[model samples]
Target: MEDQTTQPSPGSSSAAYPRWVLLEMNYKKNDEDEDSSCSTPADVKTLAAARTTSGYPIQVSLRLAEPPAASCVCLQLQVPDDVDVRYPTVVAAHGDSVLIQVTVTNDLGGFWNATTDHFVYNAGAAAAEPPREPSLSMLPPYYITDDYSGPQAHQLHTRATGLIRRGEDELVVAELSLKPARKDSLELKTAELLLFRSGEWILKRPRMSYGDREFGELPLWLHTDTVVPIGDRVLCWVNLVMGLLFCDVFEESPILQYVQLPMDPCYGKPSNRNVCVTDGGGALKFVNIFPRCCCGFVGATGCQRSHGVYVVNTWTLRMSDMEWVKDGMVDATELWALDAYKGLPRIPLSHPVVSIDEPYVICFLMIEDNKACYRDQTVWMLMVDTRSKTIQSVSLDQGERRWYPDTLIPSNVSYYLNSYPTSRSDGTSKSNGQSQIDIERSLVQVRDDDASNSMLQSSCKLSAEPAVQASEILAALQEIPSYGLDRDDMLKAAYRILSHGNGHRFRSLLSLPRNLRKDWLLMEIKASED
Candidate 1:
């Protein structure tokens, strides 16, 4: 296994520092579309801007689990100007490199899409350091959909892709696809691997080797849930319902090795509700949350609804012997009894993630009961320490501003933020490995002054207000729906209309007949369209 980036020293000045951070998968959207005439920097304004892609800008934010959510640091990715539809995913993260999978489509008519991977090295280096260009020389764009009848119809193929960084400059991109292996059975498809490295792409069909396992117990088919880079050139494709398929891509005669997972307690039930395979230290940690009924019996028949209680179980895999060791389990009742648990509701949690830094500590999200109406309600993140049997911390998840399905990825990127390459007078650049003492001292000073943390605030809040005249009542009415406070009269009018039952204002917008305000809003919409 490669040596991952080290966390801050315990003697550092910045008390209560973080190790691994929770990365927001979806890109952060800037307010450049609100007014195009602003004087923001060309690089900042053009990043993920609609002018380049006709879609929302792309940026990712990092937040400490223990701190308030407002202390997030947003990062803008370097996007090329030729793409139309931009979809980015953090495929792999190790040391100081973050591999981003950019699924782009230059087709304005939305007929096709392709993949371009970006490697961000030394991601959180100092702003004063020179910019390092990422390696993005990839194959030509191809269609993701097979139904496309365009000129590039021959390039239509869909497959699951993953990335792994071998050393400093060497990287590997792997694509997995299944082809039918006869017998008129869809479950008998053969696995094939397409590898890209050293400026060349190779397509090979590897043999599937199952050791000490009965063929009857094998999974009917392989459905990859997620791909994990299990160091030493080994990449794992995990299926929550089935097992894991590990393959060493660099081997001359690589083989897809199979390892069956432990007996799932939630099997025959809703097993997919809360399950995750996370990296713990250098081993693989599997987390599964079992919904326990109030009257026992694993939330089965003769019990109440499976809503509130749950049990979180964790297991660590010792790679040497390919064995899973049961770590520990924590019940929801033990957490609710703690004082810190009072801050969070006693609701069933979703998206249970095991902390990579502290394997005993688990992070979960408490969303609304109604899955469809979850966007309208508040989302909370809970950090529970199973070893100590205490709730570590809870923070409000800014759900409305962020896109959904943004899986929480725990990475050591936070440890590299303070480590950057220092240049000498002769133009020689080298990393100061032990300069974290100075970095922690500077961070302590920044945290002392609240005003110095403006970068942590929301991008929309930092945007300058557009020029609005008080006499422009139409503009005021138009901005009311946005809930902007640029015009005081318009804000008060809208509030009066919304809060009509307060009985404070006699002549409110609602009291002036509902049709009158509706007609004015319709006219504003029509005029804006014109």
Candidate 2:
């Protein structure tokens, strides 16, 4: 009988295999013959190099690290004859471990070519591998307070939801309660106020104290009745100082507090004295007082004064002396003032005057010309400098005062005067005048619309939805009963949930009572158990 075997050529693109063994072999004398018989080794080798019907060459090889100690042998069969023959043969051992290998070759370097040693393993094997987990870090929280009101005891708060950054501050929001002092005792006493935040209340002691006296009394007292917020700090000045006593409550402890008094140069002096309070530069002085109406002191300046036309003076009480005046003596000379207005007025007392510095005072007057002439129907603005003791007036070409008080002097002393002419309907003005007003109004409307649209778009872009959602998820985790999670764990989980998804939307969803109530109850149970 003839024996048949196959082998791959050197440098062939074929996989290495273990020892080859042949149990039965056959070979055909003719290449086209169907009946084949086993052939010799040389014939087998030739067959291995030749291609078979399956487009592969019949080949067989052996790869051996070590032979078996016992009689059992491990072997593999290579099928170079069939190109697509992935599994050519199967080998098994009865009692010992056996290695079975299959060889595949490619002319285009598609198989285990020497140039590319890359190998592909089984998907099942890869799936059985383990996975990795995630890690995180944490932060702390803080508080902040702003603009407070006493009368309408309220303030704004910007509270933090989770761990605050190291330097971040939280805002406190709260309402306040205010009570007026006794009318008789008000003169010699200061009002005491309180602040509240996060269920904790603090007392704010604001006493009017003179330099030597422990506490001096105020002549009048007033408080705010609205909620005060840090953002609305400007409203604090609205707490009118009728006589001397003025107080306000704030939601958050202020980082800084400032009090402004009208530029009253003759505040502590006798009503009849000709007090000459200078603007440092020989520009202005407050002389004489009206005594009865409390409007006597008029600003005056010598023509020789080189300072600007309108300069107001301001004085502040020293921290060492908390009184408006020290030892019946005012720090009359140590004052800071700034130029606030321009031009000189003909009628000084009839116009408004104000100071830009401490004791910052302002005066306002409305002028109406009823004469038949066109200029007579106009109104003018008169601003006075309490410090420089000078007057400045601007024509407000409008026919009548349509604005309340018709004029306003902003607390910000640096404000410039604004004026516009009103078109007369009595056929005295030209048709083009009405067109100008219409054009101005149209421009204003366009600007307002553009601004509104921009604001809305910006708000949508920076919406707090994502953060809120994360907070909700965290809150939900915190509420889990029987979780046995520590505060750190809860925070971690919350942060994780918040870090993903639309945080603000998540927060809103979590805030829903239907969703949050259950979590709250569960959290309560968990808390009780802990």
Candidate 3:
């Protein structure tokens, strides 16, 4: 990458620069430097061509001849101001091993010097895939439980099921249901979540709600609008039950953690279950949107109950840094906020998601007025953008297919790695074991109605083959013996969650009935164990 020049802070000495060796982007020496013709990439040359005497950035890379050291190795990257240095710009991998990854995009074509945390650390490298001859684990039980409590043998429901595949990071998210710790309590709202990658299982933040009011049995569920995967981080547009999405930004550093975004109108609180979309830019551009809350502009006016041009708005998140100002000597941070699209009259928008095309977002507008403004019950495509502050209404072509957050577009082929099992285990399989997406089965709750099928009709088709031998998982007081409920009747409350889920390998199963227990949501996940 090209070098960027900046004025040093007043009275700050050059010693303020980091002591670790600074890595440059345009080093021409490497394994193939002896023969440059074979090793060059067209993208690299296109970047180099943009350089000028005045100055511009060029890409840089440092590939270890062997694996990285156990200790962390910090990297200093040079990018342009407009390059969009958010996460992995590119990633190089051999088999399952990640050799090098570029996480920034330069817009100005010159190197803008940017600082990042520890760049290379071999933390999970040892957890690489096992030999072809696999051996199961003995400790955390890489296998499913032997419990035989199910409507059809030993199956379980899971909603904490999703996958993130950008460059080198393939994080598979799954939830683990637990038996409660005390009486009067159902299950832990903060249930455990395991992220599977390479050949190992990594535990991530559990299913939690913001837990502001009280640490109730409900989880701090940031309802997933959609997962926006950048180079090394995956940003989730989650909600707070109001259908407004907020961003959960995960940063990969020496310490893997979620960095809080700018203060939202919600007073820096997290929520769940809202519609969301992404800009598909290099940095994570998460826009959690919902039907406009027309309750007098940020007031609690039960706006959904009122009828009008039902508009939409979004709260967003992006990469930011906490600065120690030379003037104040204290940390100050620039933040993000809700930027509403202008140029359009107030209109009602249904569950909206991002369009595959850039500078456009797709959502359906409803004729929400009791007056004769627009056709009632008819859906129109609403295209909106914040930077442009513009909105447009368009009619779909006759016989044209519609899209939704869960809409299934036809693909040449799909190998549903995380679908139902052929045998009697749960819906998941470990990497070292059978190739099933290592999900387990337990009895959970299911709603008894076909009213929700209309949403599925618009979503995408099946991603994996449907199981010929499908089963349902239910929760029984019988499973928990010591929650002070020795009697089988009072132990685990009797509950049933049928696998009537729909969309994207039943990914939308998360919308199961709300009557289901807060601690144990009704999820129809695939069972991997037999």
lDDT of 2 by residue, 1-530 (tens): 01132332444432222121111111112123211111222211112122232233233321111111001111122334323223222121100111122234345555442110101100011111231111111111113355773232122211100010111122122222223455555434344443333334455555543223444334443443111111111112112223122222332433213333334443222211211111111111122221111111223334433121221222222223222211011111111121323232222122222221212233334344456754344344443333223333233423221222211211110010001122222233211221212211211100111113222233233223433543345445444333333333333433443343445323422433342233332222222222
Question: Where does the lowest 10-residue lDDT sum fall in candidate 1?
Answer: 439-448
Write one digit per residue (lDDT tens) for candidate 1, span 1-530: 11112233345332222445665555444455322211122222112111112233444333333421322333344444654334445555554455554444655464656544343333333222553322222233322344556443122122256566655567676767766676577677687787766655677777786875423223365666566666548778777767777888898767888877776575332232333334333557677776666544354343444456666666566566676655555556656666677767776666666655444567777765446764466777777765445677788855535445345555555543433433422243432221212111211110111211122222112222233222233333443332223333323443333323332121222222232333232222222222
In order, the Cα lDDT scores of the candidates are: 0.48, 0.25, 0.25
Candidate 2: worst-modelled 10 consecutive residues by lDDT: 116-125
Off by over 4 Å in 3: 1-143, 149-159, 166-183, 186-188, 199-230, 235-237, 242-307, 321-347, 355-377, 389-530
Q: Candidate 2 lDDT (Cα, whole model)? A: 0.25
In model 3, what is the error at residue 245, expressed in angstroms? 12
RMSD of each: 22.5, 43.9, 26.7
Error of 1 at 504 (Å): 52
TM-score for predicted model 3 compared with the true structure = 0.32
Cand. 1 TM to true fold = 0.60
| TM-scores for every predicted model | 0.60, 0.24, 0.32
Q: Could you give candidate 3's per-residue lDDT for residues 1-530 as a string of tens digits?
A: 12222222345221111101111112222233322211323111101112222233323222211000000111233433464433321121111121122234334445553322111111121123521211111111133444674222111121223234344344332323333535665433333444444545555544333413223233333333223333334434323333221222233221212334333234222221122322222222223222223222332235544333222233233233321111000000000111222332344344344332231233333223336644233333444442222344343322111111122110100111112212111222321221111111132223332222222222212232243112112222112222232222211121112233222222212222222222222221111111
Q: 80, model 1: CA deviation in Å?
A: 12
Best by the lDDT measure: 1
Q: How much lDDT does candidate 1 score? A: 0.48
